[model samples]
Target: MPETYRVAIMGATGAVGTELLDLLAERNFPVEELVLLASPRSVGRELTFKGQSIKVQDINQIDFSDIDLVLASAGGSVSKEWAPKAAAAGAIVVDNSSAFRMDPTVPLIVPEVNPEAVLEHKGIIANPNCTTILMGVALWPLHQYQPIERVVVSTYQSASGAGARAMEEVKQQAQAILRDEKPVTEAFPYPLAFNLFPHNSPLDDRGYCQEEMKMVNETRKIFGVSDLRLSATCVRVPVLRAHSEAINIEFQQPLAVAKALELLHAAPGIKVVEDWDANYFPMPMEASGQDDVLVGRVRTDLSHKCGLELWLSGDQIRKGAALNAVQIAELLVKKQLLKSKTVA
Candidate 1:
């Protein structure tokens, strides 16, 4: 008999939450039952899955005891409040927030880079930040070939990372600008249309914003390297979805461009798209809605013999958040790591 699991999406009506629902159906996960959960204002909203309409339920009312897997994409606050309850109620959580990511106890996962780490999870797996996940997936293969000593990255992030409403706000801002009207500043601290700014997350004493630090700290945790030298600058671009990054890496051993291309081409979850003749490379438009991270512009850094530069773009809402969480759930099932007490 085929084994099936009961699954619940903690923020089913939100951006990442909606993507999670689509991925579960698109991947044909062995779901015997599906439940949609959201905040009180979103309750009773209808979302379709596998040809059936499932009404969004308030998370407070759902019984986690029967759910084998919880794909949580709600904000950090909600996850902090509910994730422990879900885990204690016998549900394995794959959380898509910053809430438990830096928690040393939870294994921060990017399945392609660190599948073995999943085996150590007690009841939860934390997905890396979108930028970190994309960079990890694209760079880990090369790192395996030659250890990376340091990384410097700059991100061109889309409004979708802020949420679906933020994306919509960008559109409205653009529309209002066309009429020469003042752009609204509700979704973001400043107008995002026809303008860009440094990531607005809170800053640390060292001046790194929370988003930038997430890449630094989360990368070290996922790669299991406590001292991996990395720094990042995150910027919010006007694009509605997907994100692009320019990465410079210093390897412990000398690596050639051809060798780097060979490693990236053979890596999982990465697509190489370089057209030197036309100077074409990965773009946010091309990467939007794609599962694989698009990587290109591989070249040797001019300043250092052991350093290399590359560009990559990926769907932030997909592989970065929802799809990664779904993949972790699949990994748990494939490895039989879901606690026996939770598996029916």
Candidate 2:
């Protein structure tokens, strides 16, 4: 018989948190007990799971001692403070925040790219940034076919990346603009309804935003290539759900278009969606609510013989956050990697 474990979701009221709840039930995780936790303000809010209303609890009030697994997605600051506490209380935390991603003692993971890393965790495992997870799953297979030299990527991120509040704010902004009214700026500094901008994450002395650097650094970590030459330009688009990326990769050797498509199609967590005749390729609308990353537009970069260009779209809230976390939890249970200390 399979072991049914107690599970707790930190930040259960947020966008990704809610999605995590859905995926856990949909995938039929063997959850003997489930607890939904969030900030104090969110306490008492009821969330449904397997047709049962689970009331949200104060994150500060929970006793992690009874929980075997914790899926945390509150935010970096929240995770920085609470994750260690949860782990100290004997829960294995799979965190969906950037707080511990770069920590030498912590393992940053995308199950498709580095499932083994999950076994190295002391008590907490870090889920890579959403963009990193989406790209890593799509590119890792190709990188394995041949070593990659350099990667240049541009992202079209949607409102969902900012959470459900921002998603609603975009719709409100669009309606206000249609009524010839001033669009309010709350979730974002600029209007995202019909406009786009460079990623708004704080910039550093090098002029690169935090979001851009996450792609650059997290990719190298997960790929185990410390000096993997990579550059990213992240833009926030008006799309409501999924994220799209245009990637140009230079490999050690030129990979033929057919071969690259074949590799991507065969890769787990990927769906090849190309139609040259209609000029149709992976699109965000089609990728939303999906479990797989939709990839297409495979072609050779004419300028460099070793370069290949492709496009991809994935649900930011689903694969980027919820599904990936759930996958990690599943991997942990399957491999008996839960409770890293016990595994050690």
TM-score of each: 0.98, 0.98
Cα lDDT of model 1 by residue, 1-344, tens digit: 55788899998999999999999999998887898999999999999999999999988888998888899988899999999999898889999999999999999999999999898887778988999999999989999999999999999999999999999999999999999999988989999999999999999999999999999999999988889999999999999999999999999988999999999999989999999999999999999999999999999999988999999999999998988899899899899766443334
1-344 per-residue lDDT for model 2 (tens digits)? 67777899999999999999999999999888889999888999999999999999988678888789999999999999989998998899999999999998998888888998887888899998989999999999999998999999999999999999999999999999999999998999999999999999999999989999999999999999999999999999999999999999999998999899888988999999999999999999999999999999999998899999999999999999999999999999889866432223
Per-candidate clash tally:
0, 0
**What lDDT score belongs to each candidate, Candidate 1 first?**
0.93, 0.92
For each candidate in turn, give its C-alpha RMSD to the true structure in angstroms: 1.2, 1.9
Candidate 2's displacement at residue 251, Å, is: 0.5
Q: Candidate 2 has which clashing residue pairs, if any?
A: none
Model 1 segments more than 4 A misplaced: 339-343
- Measured on C-alpha atoms, candidate 1 has an lDDT of 0.93
lDDT of model number 2: 0.92
CA lDDT of 257 in candidate 2? Answer: 90
Where in model 2 is the C-alpha error above 4 Å?
339-344
